[model samples]
Target: MHQDTVEKIEHALEGWPLLDSLPRECYGFHYRALCVPIDDRYDIFSYENAVIHKSVTAYYHEETHEYKLRMQVGFVEFCRIEYITNSLEIFGEKLSKELMQLLEDMVTFNPKNISSLVIKKGICDWAFAKELPETLEGYQLFIKPQQPVKINNGSYIIIDYVDFTHASDVTIYYNMYRDEFFGEARIHSIPDVTYDFDSNELVELQEKLEKHLVPRMREARQAADAAAHEGEA
Candidate 1:
């Protein structure tokens, strides 16, 4: 949160390719489905929550590219589970470059004390030249694939393990959803976390992406391309 740290982040971001919210050709990407709750006394139509909701729309347009969002928030009993549907669909954004600012903005707009922050789902997409392999070892070769979904087609594969980030307190599920029809490879991460956005956490997430996630994505892409070529022959 220090000015110096903020400045450092800004400088580091200069090298990153700008992420299009809705890229026509989506490569590999990940996004958050945030569950933010208002205080018990707050009404669904309260001015603060309304403004926060509005800001969510405005920020996506002003900061990033224009994309459609699904907004679902309703009045409910205090004891029941509350749903404030706010999710970002990231087409080709690098995690380290975009995620921190997105979280900061979410916290800033909704100034009211948030009761909880749960990552409902995290999605990542990676594209390849040919279809993914039918074998288990081929599935194992994916960058950081998650668990496999039972499906007939080669549209996807899941990473072997769930990546847990203690800093953000989110469990990340990295799955590769292969779209043979579109020739794309996707990594979908569903993280469960307690929402606490701070500068330290931001730095920690960035480090995780740069150190682990990004490299794996690159490697996955390369490996997928090679396998696809081999299949062609």
Candidate 2:
């Protein structure tokens, strides 16, 4: 936006509890993120996944291991923070040097959060909950094994959260893995789906679970942040 606005966001991010809000683990990842969804739509299809930051960009992948770094970004961005160890630089920031340096020192600034997991059965997919089929304006309707099955991005299928009336209720998202040092179980982030529920009890349960989910994610994010603190020290 503006230089002053950019500076404010960067400064606030310094104390922004990304992990405290959404904590999950992936690969060798260890951090949580607070971010802006490009759009405000409750269910966005791979919305222009960009973070609000000006930083360096580079290719990052593990050399010896084929482990995939899952960069889940929306409210929070999480992935193996270590993966960016040698993968970034920032010479393009238009902001003055002093302000840019704070962000440069704080984050690696990669907004391309990629994931491979699909929503599983027990957990709630925000996408499925917000799915409004056959009647949604400016969007295509489709049926498939999964909810919100968009084979092609539509005029409405364009998942941009910046323009919507509803923002996703799920925050502080994180993934659970089996081993302490490795990730095995992946929690997927699907856009919210609109559903006409006949069961209030079911909706209540889902809402309860969803409410509880963020804190659990936060725990992991906190752990990740603590570990980061140790390593950085």
Candidate 3:
């Protein structure tokens, strides 16, 4: 990480009282989670069961050369803001604006206050398949819509497809800020796979799963089942 990059990020975070005082760590421009105090006075209960009301983290990825800003308002609710830019000035400006908006939203945040219009538009645009055959590639496919998950300062509609027979699943969501479709898959044996597709390549998501991910998962699941039965015998 460059010194200028660090300084720029710190500058963007200037007015954020919660994050301003925290120190930055090395490994790859990162800040540990900053927990927000319970009230305007920044006071916290000293009990052992204190629940984290809100938290935020910001970091820069070396491989992607992108800055990621994440804020979690409550349990199971979060927003991710990302920026891929070489200009430190631009990064600072964008980060500052997003951080300010996120903090403002948190002042009166409600987990259930998601925008249905945003969700509907995202689904209409990104969903490659609303309904798939009950079975595909010898595995039972289960498909359904998920509650919108917050991302990039707005709600993102997600559709999930599960191969119950093979213990695998693929979740698809649209990144409005990036104008790209993102697919995340969990297979039985291999590490999780995440891919980003251009808006035009939406159909390729299904093709990739049917040709590659599903078969691999089937093979891994069958082998694991066989091993378990063998041990029982």
Best by lDDT: 3
Residue by residue across 117-229, what tens digits does model 2's lDDT show? 32322223444345424323221222211222111111001121221122122221122221011011112322332221111232443454344433533443444456557
Backbone collision tally, model 2: 30
Candidate 1 regions with alpha-carbon error over 4 angstroms: 1-115, 119-201
Evaluate residue 76 in candidate 2 and report its C-alpha lDDT on the 0 to 100 scale. 26
Considering lDDT, where higher is better, how would the candidates rank from best to worst? 3, 2, 1
Which regions of candidate 2 deviate over 4 angstroms? Answer: 1-72, 79-82, 86-174, 178-205, 209-233
- lDDT of the candidates, in the order given: 0.26, 0.27, 0.46
RMSD of each: 21.5, 18.5, 11.6
* Residues 15-99, model 1: lDDT tens digits: 4243223222211222332222223111111112332221211112212222222221111001101121122223114332543
What ranges in model 3 sit over 4 Å off?
Answer: 1-122, 125-128, 133-148, 151-157, 163-168, 187-191, 196-213, 216-233
Better of 1 and 3 by lDDT: 3
User: Could you tell me which 10 consecutive residues in candidate 3 have the lowest summed lDDT?
Assistant: 41-50
